[model samples]
Target: MSHLPTLNTDTIWAILNEEIDDKIVNQLVWHYLGYRYNESKQIWDTSAVAEEWREKYPEPPDFIANRPPTVQLTRSIPKENKQLLKEYLGFKGYKIGEFGPRQTRRATMANWLLSYLKEKQMLA
Candidate 1:
């Protein structure tokens, strides 16, 4: 089983200060459930076309055989939330692009929310 990350508000400050990587921020704040980095569903074994290719060439070239698996994200935030967060980040003088993508924006929003809750003593 994959493990969920433990997160904290300092992660946000690190992102804002450019001390932390955007990928890390995304992983910590927005990775969808059951997602582990570089883990993805494979089509080579299931696709009819791929199976046909295997029958024609039993031994694939090294490049094809050793190709790294890629990950397809299930997505981080809902569309409605993305729009709201985009507008909010823009209002705060941030370029949404700076956050990396949907997942990164979700991280930023999460950091902001955590900070807010902390300030209000709502989080321990």
Candidate 2:
């Protein structure tokens, strides 16, 4: 059997929640959003749509792979994804106990959650 790194999701979550800075989150989020897996074209079947989005948004300085727009996971992320999600949402500076305030923008949270599951190796 291969020796894979076993990360403590809870520990990661705690660091992200009580310690991590917004800059890292922003960077990670940017990476996650602009990420394009090598198999994007073959898997996403969105050659046209991705092009459209690219045209709309200015090209990033770094080459974030041309991936499918939708956040799809092939395997499980770590549980930390969920904790990071909660922190991400909280970082948005939204008020709690409010009724669906303004617009619903939780893409970061969703993406983090997905990534967490994948990290945990639970999505397989």
Candidate 3:
């Protein structure tokens, strides 16, 4: 009887730039480390077993059992493609979020932005 609200690429892009905020990032890190979000507390509650696994493994899961290899955000994407993506997003009034100590994942952002632009035909 419940329905999930429909969301468009514009909304998703906005959420990516706006709603995935610092507090949310911390929550995501905690959840990725295996804690569940506590709605009332607005925090993630860590489990002992999750903490143990994290201590043992320390790194995030690199692959899914039956899925393609993860996208390499660290690899350098071509500068021309990168600039095209930025120009498209800027034309559409979308601002990219700055992340990380070294800002290494801009390639992934570029990919998403360009795909959205192409989908919306804001880019030729």
Candidate 4:
């Protein structure tokens, strides 16, 4: 009854896929699995390796659980800004398709906008 939303393994995996480097994803997954396995064994030894793993892969924020279960961070963009961004990207010849498959265009745009906004200090 903690009232905190629970995040399952799949959700964690998806978030990790978006936010982390692919090279380290498998290592983190194996480390997490090992931690869970040791936890299940009930000996509960806090080994240095386990501590290191926790330091590297801290728990996701409680807010993440409350938000919609999507990799993209939710934010409202003004219609004018959206149009301006589209025009800007077009002018710069940065085609979304050039970056990746068609399905990923929205994610690509969201990430680009997030970076833009952060650089302008509009988002912290």
Candidate 5:
């Protein structure tokens, strides 16, 4: 299983200062603040820290904002298999054109639609 990269206070600070844009500082700050009774003193005042940062800098867009929504399957599948899967998705009426210009690939579009369908429990 893939693990989420650990974001330290320093790293978060750097992100807030525009040193990096890999993660959304606001979301991370909210998540940290939501953790009630965190034993770590460093992460204790996440809300205040986040507020200060927000006051100084405009909120940055989420990293996945431009990407099509999809389940990121890590397992390596053959290109031919993926193409077949895309064809199947197309046959199911999940058109790639609906998601906009960037989402032209069948693999990405199909996976995104499938992921949405699965989330709604529409697929068995």
Candidate 6:
């Protein structure tokens, strides 16, 4: 049997409240708004759509953009993806409550929760 890593509340909380790297998030948001990476030029090619989105939200929200991050676990996300994650992990808990308003620690625990379970099992 393979050794399994310890699971703890802090680890879960860390994953749930994890904030994505700024550079990655920035790239994702820019790409979502129709910006492309110019490989040869080593730059991001911007478009009118990107400009408009930037103008509208100078700092785009992590959850609303939905780039597969921790914020999706929270109720703040209007997308159904959060529900799907919970269903996949069989998480049955309060849909919404007072998480103290930071938004990061309030999201669902499905992001890395599945990995922890998978590590402890051998699907056959």
Best candidate according to TM-score: 1
Error of 5 at 80 (Å): 1.9
Local lDDT at 102 for model 4: 23
Which ten contiguous residues of candidate 2 have the minimum total lDDT?
A: 61-70
TM-score for each candidate, following the candidate numbering: 0.31, 0.31, 0.29, 0.24, 0.21, 0.30
The most accurate candidate by lDDT is 6
User: Which segments of candidate 1 are over 4 A away from where they belong?
Assistant: 1-6, 32-34, 37-122
Estimate, for each residue in 54-82, the C-alpha lDDT of model 5 and write its tens digit: 45323322323333112222122334444
lDDT of each: 0.38, 0.36, 0.38, 0.34, 0.35, 0.40
Higher-TM-score candidate of 3 and 6? 6
lDDT of 3 by residue, 33-64 (tens): 35454578875345532554445434433322
lDDT at residue 26 of model 5 (Cα atoms): 30
Which sequence of candidate numbers ranks them by lDDT, best first? 6, 3, 1, 2, 5, 4
Clashes by residue pair, model 5: none
Q: Per-residue lDDT tens digits of candidate 4, residues 1-124?
A: 1221122333233432355333233233233223322445644333433444345434321222223212222233444454433354322323555643322433333333433444455542
Span of ten consecutive residues with least summed lDDT in model 1: 64-73
Worst 10 residues of 4 by lDDT: 61-70
Candidate that beats the other on TM-score, 1 or 4, i.e. the better one: 1
**Angstrom error at residue 96, model 1:** 14
**Local lDDT at 104 for model 6:** 33
Cα RMSD for candidates in order: 12.2, 10.9, 11.1, 14.0, 15.6, 10.5
Please give the lDDT score at residue 27 for candidate 3: 31
lDDT of 6 by residue, 18-119 (tens): 444334433443343455656788754555344445454444445433444344224333443445335554445433673433333333433334343444
- Residue 96, model 2: lDDT of 68
